[model samples]
Target: MEKILVVEDDKDIRDILKIYLKTGFFEIWEAENGKQAFEVLENKEPDLVILDLMLPDINGLDICKNIRIKYKYPIIMITAKTSDQDKIAGLTYGADDYITKPFNPLEVLARVKAQLRRYKEYWKGSNEKNTIYYKGLILDRNSMHVNLNGINLKLTPTEFKLLEILLLNKGQVLSGEKLFHLLREDEYYSKSTNTITVHIRNLREKMKESFERPEYIKTVWGVGYIIED
Candidate 1:
């Protein structure tokens, strides 16, 4: 059974989510604040987390940062704030997805299912024929692991998928549209091209690559992006 943690301060909302998501396949855990959520995270590493931004102890952004420090599990941020900055902040802080308040339970469930599917595919290296390499950076399709400079770099599922795609088509330009399609097809998540850009930016940061003069992923002016071998 997959374990999922729900962290929200509103008791009614939390209960509603819990009841809606309850299934034989899922073992649900609940936390009312960020402090409690951290405790749950430390004690039991859930497969995924449903987080609310407005917390009593710590904000959801801080919680996401702390979680990203050690764990690479998928996180979905649920908040009342729908501003672009708020959404971008959540993504920048390591959230896998964001949902606004008054969201449909069915939509939330669909997003959860999509994220899990993508994580599984990337983590398990689902495509046996998809091995990628770039300038000594190797991504083993069988192992779902990335090796950079002959050293293994621990990557989150999202990071691994992005790198795999980029390295596979080294020297070939891929537009934001194409990359988004790749990710969406792999994970079943529907998102805009801007979201794809955000994920790529995050991957670049992890690889310690300069965005200004990227060696691996480069912008093709108005086209999109490409990997330079």
Candidate 2:
């Protein structure tokens, strides 16, 4: 059974989540504040965490950072703050998804299931493909860590996912359109957006490489980009 840890300040919200998600194949764990949530995380080790942004003790962003620092476990942040900046902050801090308050519990459940699916797929890549080697670099999805010549590269969650996609499809030309869709899923992306280019540039910079004369992500002129084998 997959375990779910729900961290919320409201007792009613916690009970509602348990009532809906506690199926025979899924066990539900609850904590009313960030302190209790961390205690549960230390002991129970949930498969996924549903964290409230407005926790009474310890900001939810702090909790997200702490979780990302040690573990790559998927986190779906729930908050009343629905601004784009707030949402971006959640993602920038390693949240896999975000939900607003007064949301449909059914929608929450769906997002929960979707995150687990992607999380499982992400880890499974390491099991099937093992380390992805290119030049002197090594990528280990299982550990959510990457290193070049034994030196770890400090990567944001977005950068890590972008690199993972590029390495997974090594030598195959991946269009910017495909990458954006894959990275952001069916979210608020549009054809006119150049988000992929920005992310690619950032990734290349971290690789100490560039698109003009590249060693890693090679832009195939009019054909998007590829990591040459």
Candidate 3:
């Protein structure tokens, strides 16, 4: 069974999430605050993390950043803040998905399943494709890794997926909407295109590409983004 660590301060919310996750047949771990969350993470790396932004001891964004430093496991942030800026901030800090408070437990379960599916697929390199190279950047599908100038790039599953799609469709401009739809499949989490934009920006940063004169992924202004072959 896949293990999931849920770092939520509210005992009620944590219990509710635990019940649902248990029903899903996942091995569930719970942390009532950020300190305990780190304690759990120090010994065990869960397959995924359901982290709340508002923690008592430490900020959840800080926790996310710390996790991203060494691990690339998928992180889904849950919080009461619903603003676009909050969502963007979470994504910028390396969260793969975001959920607001007062959400249905079923929705959370569905999102968990969706994220895990993509995570496993990407990490396992199930596409059976070969390496894709662009200049000095290289993506090895069999190993499910990306390297830039002989240094391995640490990317979240979302960023890796975006880069893989762009490389696969080299020379084609893919709109934010199209890319979101492709990554999310039938899931309609939100209609806003900001999610795609944030992930693209994260990918660019990881590849160390200049925003103004990007040699790899180029913005097509009103169109979309293209990786010229």
Candidate 4:
């Protein structure tokens, strides 16, 4: 059974998730703070981590950053902060997904399952072409590696997926809503364009592409974003 480590301080929230995730048949580990979270990590490695941004000790962003240094497992950040900046901050720190407070338990469950599936698929490789070469960039699906101008660049799964999609559909515009739907691996739609915006910004920064005059992945204003062939 896949294990899930939930780092949440609120007992009620934790209990709610425990019940729902347990129903999903996942082995759940509970941690009320960053300290206990690390302790859990020391003893057992979970397949996915459900992290809360507001903790009694140790900010959740720091915990996510620390985890990224060593582990590549998927992380879903849960926080009461509803602002786009808050969500962007979480993503900037390497979180795979973000959920605001008052979120539906079912949505959380769905995201957890979606993340695990994507994580597993990333490691195992998919049926798509093993490698794609465009301009000075090389993306290898089998190895889950990307290189640009003979230099390797580390990318989060979300960033990698976005790049793959853009490359596959090069020279075409894809709206944020469309990209978000594709990323979620479901048809669920919400006014969450900021998620894609932050991710694309991250991708550009890693690629060293200038936002003002990008060589690739250019924004189309009211249309969407596209990568020129």
Instruction: For candidate 3, list the clashing residue pairs, or say none.
Output: none
Winner by lDDT between candidate 3 and candidate 1: 3
Where does model 3 exceed 4 Å of error?
125-127
Question: What lDDT, from 0 to 1, does candidate 4 have?
Answer: 0.90
RMSD of 1: 2.5
Best by TM-score: 3
Winner on lDDT between 2 and 4 is 4
Clashing pairs in 4: none
lDDT of 4 by residue, 1-229 (tens): 9999999999999999999999899999999999999999988899999999999999999999998877778999999998888989999999989999988999899889998987787778467777999989999986778999999887877888889889998988999988888777775536566789999999999999987999889999998999887
* Candidate order (lDDT): 4, 3, 1, 2
Which 10 consecutive positions of candidate 1 have the poorest summed lDDT? 183-192
Better candidate by TM-score, 3 or 4: 3
| TM of each candidate vs. truth | 0.87, 0.73, 0.95, 0.93
Residue 66 in candidate 2, Cα distance off native in Å: 1.2
lDDT by residue (tens digit), candidate 2, 1-229: 8999999999999888887777435699889998999899788788889999889989999999898787767788898996867866776666766788888777677667766766676666443766778888898877667898778876655567778899988879989888877776645434333546666766676678855688888898787989887
Q: Which ten residues in a row have the lowest lDDT in candidate 3?
A: 121-130
Per-residue lDDT of 1-229 in model 1, one digit per residue for the tens? 7888999999998877877777436778999998899889878999889999989889999998888888877899999997888988888888888889998877777777777877776555353565666787788866667787877776656667777887777778888888877865744444456777777777777677897897777888899888876
Q: Kindly report which residue stretches of model 4 are placed more than 4 angstroms away from their true locations once superposed.
A: none
Candidate 1 regions exceeding 4 Å error are: 125-131, 141-144, 150-154, 186-191
